[model samples]
Target: MSTIPTTAVAIEPLSISDRLSLVWRIPLLVIRCAANFASFCLSNGEIARLDWRQKLAHAYLRASRVTLTRKQQAQQRKLLTGPRIQGYCHRYNLEHRAVSVNNDTLYKKRDIPTPVLHFVKNPTTQPDGPTIFYLHGGGYHNPIKEQGHIPLALQFAAACKAKQVVFLEYSLSPEQQYPCQLIQAVAGLRYLLEQEAVQAENIVLVGDSAGGHLTASLLTHIVHPSPYAPPIDLRGRQLKAVLLVSPWMAMSEEQIKVLPRAPNDFLTRESIVRFSNMFKPGLNEVWSNRCDMHDAVAVWKKLFPTSHEHAICRKAMLAVGTSEVLLDSCVSFALECMGCETIYVNGQSDLRLVKEADFVLAIAPGEAHVQPGMDCALGYHDGKMMKAISTFLEAC
Candidate 1:
């Protein structure tokens, strides 16, 4: 049996000097963006191939990436949280319930804020249908976007014909790190199972980017509990499905820099590195090098050690854009899940077997990082990727 890597490291908070450096870095980044824009106009490159809206979005993302530090991002999240929730309730005509999960012993010991499970009440949902537990992705530092994440979750709930969508508003990073978010996530699911009497088989765990990391972590924790987190036993229950959208699997800066760059992708290596550093501050070599969740086969094996032991889930879907910075890692993770021994570097056809494995890996052509979710958030649902996801969920 393969041993899971230990993540026992002290929390290293950013120093005063590191925070102050952002003042100078912001202006420098603006200047760099201006230069890049000039070059982009001159060359018929990848950026030129993108549609007008994509181009505009990419430019905005590049500018904002460096300007807003994690601290500022957290502050912005607080301001937007109230309005975003209210907007979703009004627009979707769904009832909102902010259920608190703070009674857990770990939370009280750590003095962590009560994590709120934002339940989106969908009246048309079938009582026996799946219940989605969504974890929004903002590199673990930013809050769930009103325009982006909420709509995307609702779109997924609609596609799956789920009864209701529950969003775990897990605590943000820098302010709260690593096991804290993981603990809150476990607590949220426990609340669903114990308090609400929701059966494990009826739940579908869905997350994108950093939220994807948390989702995977939750599964890992169930198989082998984390040292710092509160203990949780699934009672031999398995989830209906797990949907990982453009998951941020690679945690190290070295890993990020080594991956092939995607010119059209808005997510940058520097931004990812910064977010990762803030999320898991001081890490030992094992923890810093890779996220154990990337080894899907090992996780699956440990999760279902014997035939009598239940599998983690009945179905799993990993959706990634061809043009994402995290594309390579996502593909590697998919391959692991599919139990492929031989590597296929250039051949996309080999991945077709993924469907047969009960683990689907959907690749969106010419799209960039979580584009399906972004499109849904932006009120555009014509993408084939969205249809693929809906079909996968419907079949489940």
Candidate 2:
């Protein structure tokens, strides 16, 4: 087993100064929204492809991208922390607990605050049932949205009948870089095993976009220990499952630009590269190269060499929309997980054979990035894809 860190990092409260700064940006935000609307109107082809709901969501995300800087978004995220977040949980009748993790062994810098593990549980949740370790995705920069992320978490908990949901509030990028978020995640997982007494086999790692990238990073660290981070020992056990939603698997700018642009998808090449650089400054191609289609099989073999050492998990599901910008990479990664030969062709094929395999690939037709979760946040349930996800998790 990995050694747990001895020190704990405290959660810093947001100051009045931080809240005051946001008031001045309201006018600018309005201007940006108007500009985004004009751009949306001009893109007739893209608009034609999207449903009414997707069109509005795409517009909102685009405006948000321009209106708020990552730092501002980070500051706004502070409002959702502590008692505020707990209050939100109360509305759903879910219990909330905050656990601060020690980062003394994880980082040498004292300024980098320790990560927080937000434990949320439904009233009907079973004590010894499955536990979800959720990692929110915002390109490793933007703060989690109360309306979007909180509801999405509740949906997952309901879907799997989870005993508890552990959301890791890891440090954001530009301020904190690679291995910092990675190590903090390891620290959070350690807390689940050592403190909470949760079995490794009952833990499910669920992450969206960049969180999905972090989830994959954790798996790699398990197979080959990172010198910078503490190692975890599963005690001859494997995780219950891994569910990645619209994962940002590829980091290469050239590779990402080469992929066919999905008009309805909100992601852009420029935004992806900018976020990737913030997460890993002076970016090297070594990490991104591992995701290449030609090397996928070899990479998966190295990560999950044997059944006993199943660092990847006992079962896996990779869900991506047919209209996602990262569709190619997501599909490739899913194929690797299934240990199948990589197929480069565009439209869906025999990938549905995943129903018979331990690794499943779910494609949401006519949807955009992280569509199901986004839809859930909008109070739209009853999606066929989401039901499939619930069925998959229950079976696992």
After aligning candidate 2 to the native by TM-score, how far in Å is the CA of 205 from where it should be?
Answer: 0.6
Q: How well does each candidate superpose onto the true structure, as a TM-score?
A: 0.78, 0.78
In candidate 1, the residue pairs with backbone N, CA or C atoms under 3 Å apart (3 or more residues apart, or in different chains) clash, namely none
lDDT of 2 by residue, 1-396 (tens): 111222232335546775566676677777766665566566645344444555566666666666665555555544433343566787767778887887674466534557788888877687777999998888886656666777776777776788988888787775677767777888888889888888888999999998888887777666656665678777778888888888888776666677777755778777788888878722332232344454454556765554524445787777777668888888877775544322221222433343444666776565668876667666765443455456567667
Task: Look at candidate 1 and tell me the lDDT of residue 15.
Answer: 64
Tens digits of per-residue lDDT for model 1 on 1-396?
Answer: 111111122334556875686678778777766755565556565445444444445555666665666554444544334346666787878888777775747777876656778778666677777899998898887777887888888778887789899988776767778767777888888899989888888999999999887887787777766675666666777788888888888886666778787776878777788888888833432222244444444655665343413568877788876678998988886665433222221223433344344566777665678776667655676554565566668677
Query: In candidate 1, where is summed lDDT lowest over 10 consecutive residues?
Result: 1-10
Candidate with maximal lDDT: 1
Residue-pair clash count for candidate 2: 0
lDDT of 2 at 110: 34
